[model samples]
Structures are given as C-alpha cells and as structure tokens.
Target: MANYTDWNQALIDYFIKGTPHGTKIYLSVDEDVIERIGYHFGQSSTNVIWVNDFCIAVRIKVIFEGQVNLQHLKGRDSQGLPKGVAFLCATILAASQMAQEEKTSETNYFKRLREILALDGFARPLGMKFGNEAEEPLWREWNRWLMEDRFLPSAQRGGGAATYINYPISQSLLRRTDKDRLRKLFQEKQWQAEWDAQTLFAHVRREAGAFGIHLKDLLTENKQRHEAIVEALHQVYEQWKAQGCPTADKNNYCTWSRHLFCGLYRTEEPFLGQVDYYLYPKQQRGRSLESVEVKQGDNLHLLREERPGWYFPLEYSVSQKELDNGAKYQISSPNDLDYLILPARDFWILIPDAENPDSGAYASWQAPSLGTEFILLCKQELVSDIERLRDEHLLKSSCTPQPIFNNSGWVELQQCMVVSQAWDGVFIKNQALKDALQPSVKLLISFSGGLRVPKIGAWLVNHGPQITIFGFYSTAELKVTRLSDNQIILESSQSTNTSIRLDFSDPGHYLIEATFAGESSQRLVKIVDWDELAIEKYVHPEVMAINSEYHIFGSVIGQIF
Candidate 1:
C-alpha cells in the first residue's frame, strides 16, 4: 500500500499541477477507493487544491452498486490496487474520460453536485435523497460536532466562521412530533444567549436544516404565528377594558402596555373586590355660615374642643339649593354620629364620633397605617376568556408567556384619591374596617419661587429671596429643618392651603416635613447659588455664510467671554 506521503504527492501531481484557477474537476470512483482513503463520500465530497496562486475545487463522487469500468485499469485486479494510490488513479482516469465529453452534457450531469457543494460545509450522503428520505440524526450529530468541537470558530470569540451540514427539508418529511420538538428547540435560552435576533435565527435555521427545512420558509411561518399571538392578546385586553377591569376575576392579566388599566395593578392575579368608601376634599369655610375664601395672609384659627378627641370641631352649613334638592337635615348631637371622616390629602383620618369611646380607635388612627388599597371589580368570565386565549394561542405556539408583574400575584396601590364625599364611596385600606368611613386621598406638594432642576434633585434660587413651599389639598402642619445641623427652620400649624417661605441665603440641603392627622411625609430641598448665567455657542469650521453680494466665505466663530 502507498504511504501517506506517496499518496499526497500523487494527488498533488494529478490534481494540482498546471490546473487553472477557478477550475472545477469531478472524479467518480468506486466504493472501495473511498474506503481506501478512509473518507465517506455521500453523493459527493469536495476539497481544494492551490495551483499557481489560484484555487482549483475538486469534487469526488462515489459510484456505488456499479463498476466504474476505468479503461486505464482494465487489466489490473481491483483488490490488488494500493489503498491510497487507488483514489489517485481513479481521479486521473475519470478526468481524462470526462474531458472528451460534450461540455453541455457534462454540465447537466453535475448540476445536482454543484447545488450540494454550493452550501457552506454541506455534503449529501449516498443514503440521503433530496425531497425524499434523509438521515436527520446523522446530520444533527455532524452539526453538533461542528459547533461543540469548534470545527469552526465561535462568534463569542470574535470569529464569524460558521460550518454546518445542511439538507433540503420537505414538508412531507416532517411529522407532528418533529415540528413540536423544533418549536421547543427554537425557544431554548441556551442557544439564544449572547446571540442577536439574526444570529439566533441562523442557528435555529441550521437546526431546522437537519430536518430539511429552509430558513426563509421557517421565518415566514414564524412571522405569521407571532402576529396571531399579538392579535389574540389585543383582543383580550380590549374585552377586559370594556368590562370595567374587575379585580376579582379569575383571568390572568399581563403587563403588555403602559396605557392598559391592568398595568396599574402590576400583577398577574390582582386582588379583586368592591370599594366601600369615597374620598372628597375637605370644605374650607369662613367663621360665618357662608363659604369663605381663606387667603395665605389670613390669621383665622380653626376651633376644636380642648378635651381629648379625635375629630376636630368644624361647622358645616347646609346650602339652600342642597335643601331644596331633597337633602336630609338630621338634628343630632356629637353622640348620635358614630363615625367622623376627616378627608385630608395624605391622611384619611377615621375616628369614632362619640366622645372618647375606646383606645382602639385612637390606636388605629395613630398606628401609621399609610397604605392605599385598590379594589378591581371585574367580570369573572372576561378574565377566563383571556386565560383561554393565552393557553390556546401562546402556550401551544411555544411563545413564552409574559412574566407576572408581582411574583406574589397581589396588587398594591401606591397612591389613592377620593373623588367626592357626598356619594357613598368604596374605601379600601390596609386595615379592612367594614364600617370604616374613610376615603383614599393623595398628598399634593407644590414648590415655587425657584428654578426646579430635576436632574440634580435640587431647586435653584437666588441667595436673598425665599422659596415658597405650598401644600395644596392638605390640612397638615408644615415643618422645615436644616439637614446639615438638624435645626428647626420653620414650623406652622395652618390647616388648609398652608404656605411657608424659607430663606435660602446659604447653599446647602434642607428637609421639609409635613404632618397631617399623625401621618407625616418628608421632602428634601437643595439650595444652590445663582451667580452668573450665559448662553454657550458652538461654531462649526466647515459652515459657510454668504454676504449680500452673494459671495460665500468662511465666518469667524466667537466665544462668549
């Protein structure tokens, strides 16, 4: 048998020497020759040869179940041929015979060979047929070796080389189970890691190539599937919105968009119930029975009984229009009213109207329960329909479901407000007092007399003037302190529309605290110096201007001094 060196030299002489660049040569050999070379020729295998600074691509085909009838080796016994030399002899004999055939006939004969070799690193095996049976497991194994064994460089290592054994997949060859497997494989995160959408699609396509499907066709089908899923989700959202967004429904809501009311709940399964109370802004009036306009400079004092009590004493005069519109006028002392509702912005203070009944009511108000509750009254069937759609369209399609907003599946309202006090409103609080006459309200803090710089979380003001802080819709006492020294700067006990003027002569940070009905909220105010300001200009050297004479010239750029 010829050794490796002798075989290599023989191949170089017969295939490479004097061959022109871009020339393609075909060699057909018997199965024994391929076995001798220790290479498996599927339908065809290709190798490259360099000649005179050019490449000659050689395609080798194995003639199975038939004798090649090579005229040059007619007298020789096939079994006696040397292992490596057999491949070289067969190649030379085939080339000499094919060179004399008509060029058009030769081209038509090797058209399938050209198609197989056109794909990168792809080769067709004798056992596999196009649009027919395919050895999918064998192809998948080769591809896995190419990827995991680093047969080609990895993209993660900054190499763009890709190699895969691909076959044309027909729809008839794909079983239902195979398609399901492909769907699950497409969603695998391991293959998707560090891969962009295009690269990921390519990888998936290569995997599908093992099963004989093309990337373009798969992408077209996937796009249609994705659109169907998005449409299904939209229909479910519209149905839920039309039904008043009930919180107690069995349907799972997803955070798909910001404008949807379900996004406010921020939970897949939100706690649903009915709100039993309403919040209304407190009515401010003068000492007289008529409504009064209380100004910032007014020194009016709100009178309350000095005895220990939760409800502050305030007089409410029924208007004549309200009485004429069938309003009830019930004459009852403080003892008859069982609950007193103090609807402040930050604090919805609920107290027993009776004089000092027990310590429980006082403890409930003073215990710092500052959470807001949201109750969604949803129709049960609407949510069930959404869940059904998700399972049918999303789950079966192998599309991952959107994650639950809160893992606990419970919705917590961060801020609450009361719409009106006259109507019986639903009050949902952290503590569920069935008879509790409280409404959810939010605090409003407005800052004026300064340039607000949101990026630095500070307010910029001149050194001499004071910045005014106003708490609107709040019956809260205002307190200001210098944070650096923790010194009290201002403290006022005004109830409605309280405004405090703070001098920011020095540049530093200050803390403003507002306490209303035992609930306090603190805000940080940063003082900064405003010495000088000017607009900056950037001039481009390439920019030219024309004078009145229509002469274009470069203009000099000047900087602000």
Candidate 2:
C-alpha cells in the first residue's frame, strides 16, 4: 500500500510540475474566505504554485482527511493529527502565497488543454472567515471555550474584535465519546474534562438535527444535488486510487465544484415513544393590529400589556347619515368584535387557514403538540406569569408546559415532558396506524429498505378509502386516494396515476403508512408544513449538489491564486 510520504511527494510534484516555473497564486481556507468552496471539512490544506509561463495558478492539496472521519487517519499523540498538519500547511501556504502575489491577484483557467492531469483526491475545505486582527483575544477565548469549559477573564470584559466560530473536528470529538481521554489533552475548561450536563445536552440536540436528513429525498431533488456532491467526492478518491497515488496538478485538471458536506450517522436500534412536550417559537413576525397614535413622549405604560382586547381610546370618522338613521351604537375603528382577536404576538403563527386541505401552505408555529394542554383563553396575567417562569429556565423540570415570548414577540408556548430517548427517534408518526393492515390506506413498500426500487402495489379498502401509492424515496413514500376527478387531485406528485374522489371525501386523518411483509407497521410519511417541506426541496440531492458544486468552482478560482 502507498504510504503518506508517497501521497505527499505526488502532491508536491503536481504543484512544481517537474519544470521550474513561477506562477502567481493565492490560497484560502475554511469558510473565512470571501469565496466559498464546499462543505467545511475539519482539516484541509492547499498550495498555489505560480508558473510565469501560464496565466492560471495551480491549486493543489493532499486532502489527508474529510469532514466525517472518512480518511480514518487515527493519528496518536497531541502534536495534532494529519488533519491538523494539513490545516496548518494550507493556512501557512495560502498566507505566504498571498503575501508574495499582493500586486497581481487574479487566477483564471483558460481551458487551453483537454483531458488535463487529475489530482489525487479532494475534500471540502475548512472554509472559515477571519475579521480584524484585534480579535485575537476573542478567538483565544472561543478556542479556550472549545478546549476548556472555563471562561477567559478577558472574555468577561466583553468588547473586542468579534470572531466567527465553527467546529471542524466535532465529528472526531463525538467518535471518542470518552471524557477521561479528553482530560489528558484538554484543560478542565477545555473539552478535556468530563462532559458537562448542559454542554452534552447541546451536542445531543445538534446531532438530532442531522438525523433528520433523508438521503433519497435529497437525491431526487433539483437534479440530484446531494447525490452529485457525494459522487464528486467519490470520483476524486477513486481517481486517486487508480493512479497509484500520483501527484495532482490542480491547474491542469478539470475541477469539480464544491458542495457543503452534511454529516450522516445511522442507528437501527428501535427507539420507544413516550409523551413529552417542549416550548417552541410560535411566530417570528409581529401581527398588524390597530395603531394607537400616541404623543411622541407619551408614557405608553399600557403598551406593556401588549395583549389583545386591551381597550384603547381613539377617534375616527363615521357616516353621519348612519347616525341620523338611528344607528347610534359605537363601532370601534379597528373592529375587534368581528375578529376572534389573538395577541398581536401569536397572530402571525396562528395560520387560521391550516384546516384548508387545498391551500398547501403549512403552519409556521412550532410547539409540542402532545402531553401539553394549551389553554389560550386563560387570564392574561396568569399567562404572563407562566411565560416568565419558562424564560429563566426555571420551569425546565416542571410538569406543565410553560409559555415564553422570544425577542421577536413570538409567543412560545411550552409544555413539559418526562425525559426519554424515544421522543427523538422517529421522523413522523401515522395517525391511522391501527387500520394499517386493512388496505384502505396506501402504503409504499420497499422490501430492502433501500427505497430505490420503484415497484409498487395498491391496497383497496372495499368499504372505505382506496389506497394509491406513487411517491418513492429513501425514508418515506406518498399515497393518494385513487379516483378520476379533476378537482379532487391537488398536489402533482401525489396525483401521478391516482386521483382524489370529491364525492367520497374523508376528513380527520389519513395515512400513507408503510409495513414490510414480516416487520411491524411504521409510518414513513412525514407531514411537514409548507416551509419545512420547502426545505425538503432544497436539501434534496439534486439541488444541493449542483448549487454547491458551482459555488465550489467559483471559490477555487478566487482563492486558488
């Protein structure tokens, strides 16, 4: 097997081009650079060789490792691993090259040659941005915070150059899963010591977010953007292996664009479900309510209430003919009687139209729907007290859900839950699970669990809803009511060959439930709001890959120098 030295030599040779030539080149790292490249790997390095004979600068790197520990370097000791060395080398090289080429900064490929030499391999760049140098203390503090839980004294002082932060090595850290091992290297304040409860909880939440990704959905989206990214990375690696670890001349090769990398981890162990609750943001936008004009310096004390139904005095025009017609009762300017007035705070989130099956719009509000009784009609004073309790983390252990208002005046109504791992397990639940075997509801089945197979069959509920299956993906499938009415079908995807019957409309809840021949019934359909569904479109493999690749290509040109 070729060693690291062989890989390193090839990388160096690719840049030098065997013949001596000076080229102007610039290099950048992480997301700190103005030009974006791809998903930020934990560690990376780049070399820009300037050849006077050619206008294009050669960008090269020996991508020792990738974002998800794919390279498996597993280096021992605290001198830093291959990733660290690569990161350092890339940083120093890019900086030095930029300093030398301060006068002429553009590096463009003219496409003078076809079938250019391929580079060994590529990984996403760390791609971090840097601000004013004055913020070293803050970087030191953040670094310290990352290393040690202890805060720096200077950090307490507050004002300084602001610095952005990213965790390139978070995946590696997660793999270890050992507190004592960390203590040997990092300080007590750093990540070395035993994980703190709060910090550990934060990590769990972040990982939970990643678990939410659906690969098949990602692939089918926007020309298979996500698939393109994975394929691009795979191609680079495969090419490198085929060349017997030859050096890569970045300038000579046709480069693939960079797409941000997403982390993926899998666990098949079933997770149980239990009743739990959480406080969630109700809405980000404030509602448009009656505008009460106040003198510039008016106390506006009553504004503190800010709740609906608070009487405010105002004067406005009314028809005198109506008054003469014996209609003397007062009509509020911003009429409240006709409105089932919600607080200006929560109105934006309360999509009163959620019940509309045809609107396609999803609710913006996010709150625990189970294990919490939401009493919207309770007294305002009591509600205020509940919100206050939730904000300070005082109600974290409470049995009842608490309410809170985020900075945006969003009403965050929260409920309580008994802590359990089950709540975080599944992506979506089937409301009509009990009747899953009856065949009325359509269930998309993939025997291998791969979901790639498009073969499908329908189940007919002789007395009830006729199940029609169409949509297929990695995690879930879509089923529609089979009928032949034009107005019945709303969404294009769910209406492939199937149609909805307007005459036999069934309300309440339905399911596109999935069940294997021998396995237990499970619901793969994720009923998300229109916005969350929109995310499905973006994260889809096709969309992410193409956009990311284009971004990466541009970033390389700008930073390769």
Candidate 3:
C-alpha cells in the first residue's frame, strides 16, 4: 500500500500529466484517505462519485480537462514539491472543506481561489499571466476586492470621492513573510469594517513596518505634506474671502487660487509665506515716480528691488470707456478690460498722477486676493498704442526721456521776435501778421537761455535762415555742417556760457550739429524764400494756420481771448 505522501505525489503526478476529457481514475486506499480525497474531489469538480468507501471514481470535465499541465515537473526528484504545486494541492483541499459548508457559484470559487493564492504569496510562482483572457476578469475582480476591503490607504478625500495610494499594497511587491502575516490577520478577522481613515492608516502603518516596508518613503511623508498644504491654502482662501475676494476679474481670483493650490500641493517646497500685496492706481506713500522705470511692452514696468526673484505681478487693464464708467475688469475679454498673471522681478503701480494722490479714479481699489507684490494700472487706449509701437520697434526696451529745448526759446525775424511760446499752440490767424512774417522775410531763430540739453549730449536744432543759439554749459562744443555741400559752417569750443550763430544767405537745407561733453547731435535746417510762404492761401480769417512759415504767438494769444 502507498503511504499518504506517496498517494499525494501520485495525485500530483496524475494532474501533471494533464487531465484528459471524459477520463476516469480509480484509487484504492484506507477509509481515512479515501474520505479525504473524495471530499476534496467532490467539492472541486462534479465528476467524482463514491464507488464504495474504499474506491472512488473521478472524471475530468470538458471545461477543466486540459487546464492542469505540469509536465515540466516530470523528472523532479526533490523531496519537497515546488510551492506552486503545494499551493495548488492546498487550494483543492481548502476548497473541498469550504464547499461542504456552503455552496458557491463558479465565479465565487475562482475569486476564493485567487484570494488564497494571493494571501499565500504563491500567485507569482504559479506563473498566472493576468494578460491571458481567461485570467483578466479574475485579476480585475481581485483588484476590486482589494479596494472594497480598504487594503489601500487614502491619499486624498474630497467631493464625496477619494483617491488611494496602491503602491504599498501592490501584489508585485508582496513578500512571502509579509503575505503569511497578512493571511493570519485576515483569517483571524483582525481588521474591523467600521474603521475610519485614521484607524485604517494606523493599521496600514503598523503592518507596513512589520513587513519591512518604509511608509514614509512611499506614502506617509507625502500625505502629511499634502494635508499641511491644503490646510494652509484653506486659511489663505478664508482670509481672501474675508477681504471681499478682490480679483482682476469676477471669478479669476478663486480660479487662480485653485490652480495655485494644486501646483503647490504636488511640489516638495513649502507654501507661499508672507506675501506682500500691492494695489495699483492706489497711492504708495513716500514712493517716488522716479523709482519706477517704464518698459517698452504694454503694462511692462520695473522697480528697484532688494529681493528681485520673489517679485511677481498680477496686472489689470481697462478700456477708456470702462475706466470712465467704473466697470470691473474681466479676464475673458482681453482687449476691453483684462488681467495678466506674470512672473517678474520688478513692477510698477501706475496712478493717474503721481503728484496728486487723489487724482486716480481707482484710488479706492483694493489689492487682489493672491497678494500681488507688483501691479500696474494703464489706460486702454495706451495699451494698443504701446503694443503697436513695440511691434514696429519704434520704442526702445529701456530709455529715459530727454528735453532738447527750453520753454523760453523764441523765433525771431531780422532781430524782431516773431514767436516766444511753444510751437504746438502757436497759429497764424491774421493775414496781415502772416504776410508780414513770410518765409521770404529774413528770419532768425534764437535760443535765449535755459536750453535743457541732456548732460550726455547737445541739442540738434533743424532751422531755416539765420539763427542764434545760446545756452549755459560748463564745457561744450558747437558745430554746424551743410549737408548738401558737406561744408562746416561753424565750429566753436567753449568752457563757459556762450552764444553760437549760423548764417544762411541762400535758400536750401543746412545741418546744425553740436557736441557736448563727449556726445554729439545734429538736425536739418530748411531755408526758403518769402514767395514760398503761400501767405495768401495759408493765411485765413477763421482758421488757425499752424502750417504758416512763421508762427505768431501774439495772434494765437489774441484769438484765445
């Protein structure tokens, strides 16, 4: 008679050869052995029947006929069988015992088998390819069971849904020792179904540590950091809401904060702390306009910064109509009233008038909820003009405006003053005065004093006929060159306040060039005859002729009155 181990090996050998369809095998053994084997076969398959207690009849069904194939183990002479075969035998035994107590469907039978295999760490050794069509559904069902059992810890929870961290419970990472301990706990029903998130996490933490797993590296630290960031952002949101939820647009503040929280939560860095909020069109006490520098692009400005990198801007712009009507800005309509989120090193807060704190219409405006350190307020009309100029390369990236001439400069004719005011406002309305001061009439241009020449260079005056230029300079040089003839009309070097004169005896264009310090500047001068003035047609009674050869400020002043 064969011993128990011999009978077990014989059964394994029979299955290894592959079960054939409609085949029956009879084995004669003791009552105890026959009863045990008969019970297991009856539970696992319907082909087993009792042919007296001493002998049993077994038949392979069509569905499971060719499923068992362990021919690779034919020549193995090892004392102990492989874990996979041991697990298969143990599964049949356990199923037999379970089936006798409670009947289950085929689907439940497969699920129970998978659970046993997974708990014993024999799933991988059994070479079960989840990619196989027959195994795909079972694998999915296994995953579903894991989720339902709360074996995975929650990473985040909100909106009646939760995301779980599955790495700690991944099947591929499970060790035999770990699986054994887990299997014991599961069989003992140590886990409670009513456990909360904290309680579940505590259990997971303890088990993970006993399993030689690093919870901190996998999930604990990340989860804790995420929670802390969410809390911090929540506080910030509350404060922002308390402040009326100021934004460049109606809903943009909340939207931007949501995006910010998401980005900050995923990162390893700490939250944004101690942000400085600045409002545009609001007077900054003791801050001078000279401290801000205008850039070429629309809404681009710079300021002196001690900590440059931390400076950022949340800028808003509005159309002329909106500004006048006091309409709120919107991010959707970029051309009308819009907002921009930009990362910058420096920025400016532009008010209507820097000298008058109360001049700005948006003076009472509040800061944005995100706490902007840089902000700008610009008219809508100017925004397009700035963009156009920038596209055309007409504006330099960085430049300082320079005054070329003083307000006191005047134009004269034959030593008689013709105009002594800004040219923009001067117009010739009196024909008598216009004909008297024609281009044919010899003219003289004079710069009396206070010529606001830039310290780096001299002013280039483009004038017609004789002209006298006077200014106070510590040390300067003046030069006049005829462009047509390339002839130097006059060149002078002086160390004190001096006067320079150039004479144009004929009608043509002359180049007036000057140098101060180490820099030089030049202008074109056009001299014309009196007949070229077109005095009769240009000189009008009602119209203010700014195109006249000679601008008479006296007439314009009279006309204004």
Which candidate has the top score in TM-score?
Answer: 1
Reference-based lDDT, residue 237, model 3 = 36
Summarize candidate 1's per-residue lDDT along 1-561 as a digit string, tens digits.
333334433433332222221112212222222232322112143231112001012222223332211223212224332223333333223322233332413232233333322322223334334321332332332222222211211111111211111121111112223333444454342231222122233344445445433322333243312222222223233323333343323322221111111000011212553212211112110001112211112332232322211112223422223212212222122222111222111112232211222222221221111221222212222233223333432111112222212242212122222222221233222211211222222332334444544323355554322323232344667787775687887787655444445676666666665666544444456666664233447664554435433433245543322
Q: Residue-wise lDDT of candidate 2 within 65-92, one digit each (tens)?
A: 3211212222322422122222222322
Give model 2's TM-score versus the native structure: 0.17
Residue 310 error for model 1, in Å? 44
- Over 4 Å off, model 1: 1-442, 461-474, 531-561
For each candidate, what is the lDDT?
0.29, 0.23, 0.29
Worst 10 residues of 1 by lDDT: 258-267
* TM-score for each model: 0.21, 0.17, 0.18
Candidate 3 structure quality by residue, lDDT tens digits, 243-307: 34443122221111111100000011126421122322211111122233323234444433311
Error of 3 at 113 (Å): 76
Please count the clashing residue pairs in each candidate, in the order shown.
18, 42, 1
| Candidate 3 TM-score versus the reference | 0.18
RMSD of 1: 34.2
The model with the greater TM-score, 1 or 3, is 1
